[model samples]
Target: MEAPLITADTLVALIPEILALAFIAVVLLTEVFGSRSPNLSSGLAALGALALAGSATVLLAAGFEGSFFGDGYVVDGFALLFKILVGLVAFFSVLAAARWSARTGDTGEYMSLILAVALGASLLVSGRDLFVIFVSLELATIPSYAMVAFDRRRRESSEGGMKYLLTGVVASSVLLYGLVLIYGVTGSANLSEVAAAFTADLSPAALLGLVLFLSGVAFKLSVVPFHFWTPDAYQGAPTNAAAFLSVAPKMATFALLLRVLIEGMPETAQAYTWLFALLAILSMFAGNLFALRQTNLKRMLAYSSVAHSGYILAAFAALTGPALETAVQAVIVYAVAYAVMNLGAFFVVELVGEEGKSFNGLFRTQPALAVSMAVFMAALVGIPPLSGFWGKAWVIFATAQAGAWVVVGAVIINSVLSVPYYFGVIRSMFFEEPAGVGPVKDGSGALRFSIYAMAVFTVLFAFILGPLVLLAQAIGL
Candidate 1:
């Protein structure tokens, strides 16, 4: 056969993925030379993830656009944007995991799995075919289940992993069935072909399939009604794992939702408006309201993350031209801000817990972490002068523009209701005195830098919204 077509862009597009895979290999091999030193493996892995991210940055700046593998792989502004975010999320997640991995004695495996997760996330965002998307998504999730169960000594960890496994299998089956239906109807799984199949004459079977596929994606995003697993999983998982889980998958899912909804279900918009709307309202109300009573800090953040997913759904529902761009912008900005705050919160918890005991007396012992935790909590609450405030403002504004009056109201009410619960965490840290002496350790150098960097990013991005806005626009919304 003649040589397949080759392009400079395709070569560049593979850069990050290749680097990530190589790093995973090298880290595994490095462990052989120093089997007792998991730290060496973890440090190598962190540097490799950074290198992967840097490669992605370089490729993104070089500006490659279009699809590969007969339209199975895509490289566009939107894909690049999400890939970059995934890279950053992985990079920070590595930073967050360093000390935790060292403490847990699974540094090598943890770092390797995290890299694998990043690879899956990158593929999920850039996949142009339904089959490719499905395969890529599983790659992302399977590793997560193992990562959650890494601490086999902890019963909660096992339970959490089992719960995730059960939910994940069911969700994957539903999504696959949905894809089968669409393939039967359209005779193809390519997104563009599916989009072309949308018509005023679509059968009910097609609609059902579309909805099932969406339901699967909804579960991945932890939208309400489908979000029952989030709090439990977050609570049971290790703090570092929870922090990683909170942002990475959601960002990829957001990009995937944008692609599937805009590309697959165009014909059934009217039929599905109610579905999206329900998810949005429930995620917002359920996430925020249920979070109000949680005493465990990670669980509270889990629910809060759920609530934020709802807001992003609302933005997704309002998908038209500038309106869609604004909504997506809200999600990107919020994702960035949420990543910062959530990581910062986990950093504080780990900082407090570092004394080889559970965290206690957070305020009295680690005042720096306590104050940093307060700032992060406030950001999650969408308070002003914080990036999260702008994130919500943009989403609500976009919803109003779309004439989604009920959802707009629901968004407003949810924000109002979320305040007390978020503040409750802050209040516990700053106002309530420690009931007793707990873990009394200061943060390590890596942990301290993670906290400081995230805190600064959250506050700094709150002020510079222009670049993110431009990025959303450039991503074709």
Candidate 2:
């Protein structure tokens, strides 16, 4: 018998998406009837994201694990954990945008857009079928383009948005074509069926489809060659949007990549490890090299993000070895580590002006803020005890344990390469001098609170490492 499209199981699996949709409606209606207020909209939207996160947590605690929609969507430890993370990033995005959107005069629109991206990300992590993956990715991606261009006051915002949009369209089309090709080869859209269909060899069409799909995901991860848009977009978009774009969507996309490769294409996993290794190396080199030369805060951090993609990719290179589970755990840990530290870093940029000189001698005026920023930078550099260090440490340990020393060396070299630039931010903050003839205010209260919160999390992440490992273990495919 054919299954019904909607089921009690489907409803249980989709509590986050349902709540996100309902909150979007409420946010819009309130915006239409009530006075225009950035703080109000930001609060409502962040509350919605938190509400969705709460729902996911409750579901996870209730042991809500299942394959719904004919295995197109999954509710498991893996997806549940990421849902909570994405929600947090969603909250941060709204928190940061409150002040940024005050001048834009449309908090309601951008806030809703942020929630939409959150909804998409929540769904993308659970996506197991090609159709669900494509649809969810687009849902997450389309809103990002609008958010990037939302700051019409700046010509660079428009330019960045257009560049991002144009490139995204091409990537989407390519990805869709690949999905269609895969569907044709497998004669099914479900990942289990596709996995069953793979054999000892791939036809030319299947090979081409694999390449296309990876290329599309590479665009999202800001992998080298396709990463040109990253720095420009971050530099051009509002810092709040860049903050959201950098971490949340990336976590979700990495989840999607894992689902596709491990679940949908397991037969080819060993064969693809080499490709991942090569890409990881290239991304590390290109990202760090370009980042070293960038003087702009957003652009440099943007490059750092690209380099980070490489660090995470190193885990994927170890997927075929006996350390497979370790590799997976490393990626999971790296995602959280990157999230807290990177979001803290970008939010710091939101407070300080974008130029490197704006941070010169920040320690002289705002010691606390400068110190908070230093933690984030040191973490990004993979310095000891900080979140970034833990993330890269696991990546290296996993690769080395798997005997993938080339990947290990690449990671080590890149970590060393990154130290100078990441430390550059700290140097400007402490050693140099602040710009112009005005007292630097410490930015909005909400923004400052986020910086402080993320800073603490980055510092204290080591305490949670054990729990993170257990969580990763529980995330059995």
Candidate 3:
């Protein structure tokens, strides 16, 4: 057989991935033989992420669209939107990591691993074939495993990394088995082909495969029953890694889940919808209830993450023909809102301390951080005029439109249940007496920049809802 032609369009479609890989190479090479400066390496990574984001934006504006490698890879509106999101997250993560590495040392390896993970996430969002998706997921996850263990001096780090690794391996195995069954039933690994093969009367084997596939994605999203490793992993990993892991991976996986279900298994939407509804309910109550009792800030945030995943899942469960586009918009908007607020909250945790009590009297000392934390908390509880409020509101609206009242009610109740824990940090910061004699150590400049930038974005996102809605609508199609 003759080799398939690789055209200029194919190369152009791959510029984001190519640029990310080049950045990774530069970071690693600099670590080995160059200045060995953490700041420089992280700066380069951040700049590269900005460049990639700019490229994605330009491509998006130009309405660039194409597929390559027999449709295994795609650069379309959906892919471009997610690529831009992944790039922004990577830029913030690198900025945060620069401060972390300066304190902990090992700057080059740290930045390089982050870039590698970003590359993987970017690839995952653009993947259109089963093989490509699997490889991209592994690429995104493996580096995260290393990052969880990067703080070798801490025993909890090792423990967290081990648990995360074991859980991930099992999830990957289950996911691969599901993919094999899918290929067996459809005789194709291409998502579009699989969609064409799937029928309303799905076979038991195909149904099982679909369930297993969702189970794998559920682990990444940290939904209930598949979220056993989340709190430990978050509490144990370096805070910056936890922040990145909490946002970027979830966004990418959610993107993949949307693609797989909507494109590859639309015929089974009703079955998956019910399954997701059940998971969403379980995750919301379980995560919030567990968080309510937590004293450690990281663990609380980890549980909060699980609950937020439920919010996004609620949107997924509400998917129907009439509500389909709206549901997609809900998920995307929520993902971005969650990324900004959640990352800001984690940055605060990194600045103050990981324990909830450490925030006592923060308003008396770090007034700016205290105020920012309060905004994040309010936004998290779905208070109006904040990005998070709009995110949850959209999900509720979409679910109501789809007649998924159970999901809508669950989301509302979860939002109420979440308030106590979310505000607990605020109370500690503003109302409680100081536990220490002085202010918390001011974070490094990069860390401060990340925190302030995210905080500003969280507040400003509400005003830009119109443009964001349009963007989401564009990508949904």
Best by lDDT: 2
**Candidate 3 local lDDT, 367-418, one digit each (tens):** 8888999999998888888889999999998899889999999999999999
Model 2 lDDT tens row, 1-477: 898988887898898889998888888878899988777888899899998899999998888998988778898988999999999889877887787786688989989999999999999999988999999999999999999998988999999999999999999999999999989988999888888766548889888888888889999999987898999899999998998999999999998888787888876876778889999999999999999999999999899999999999989998875878888888999999999999999998988878888888888888899999999999998888989889988998888888889999999999999988989889878788666542345438888888899999999999988888887898765
In model 2, how large is the Cα lDDT of residue 290?
93
Candidate 1 local distance difference test against the native: 0.78
Backbone collisions counted per model: 0, 2, 0
**TM-score on alpha carbons, each prediction:** 0.94, 0.98, 0.98
Across residues 431-465, which tens digit of lDDT does each residue of candidate 1 receive? 66676664544336776788888888877875567
Off by over 4 Å in 1: 1-8, 353-361, 436-443
Clashing pairs in 3: none
Q: Report the C-alpha displacement of residue 349, candidate 1, in angstroms.
A: 2.5
In candidate 1, position 127 carries an lDDT of: 83
Error of 3 at 329 (Å): 0.4
TM accuracy, model 1: 0.94
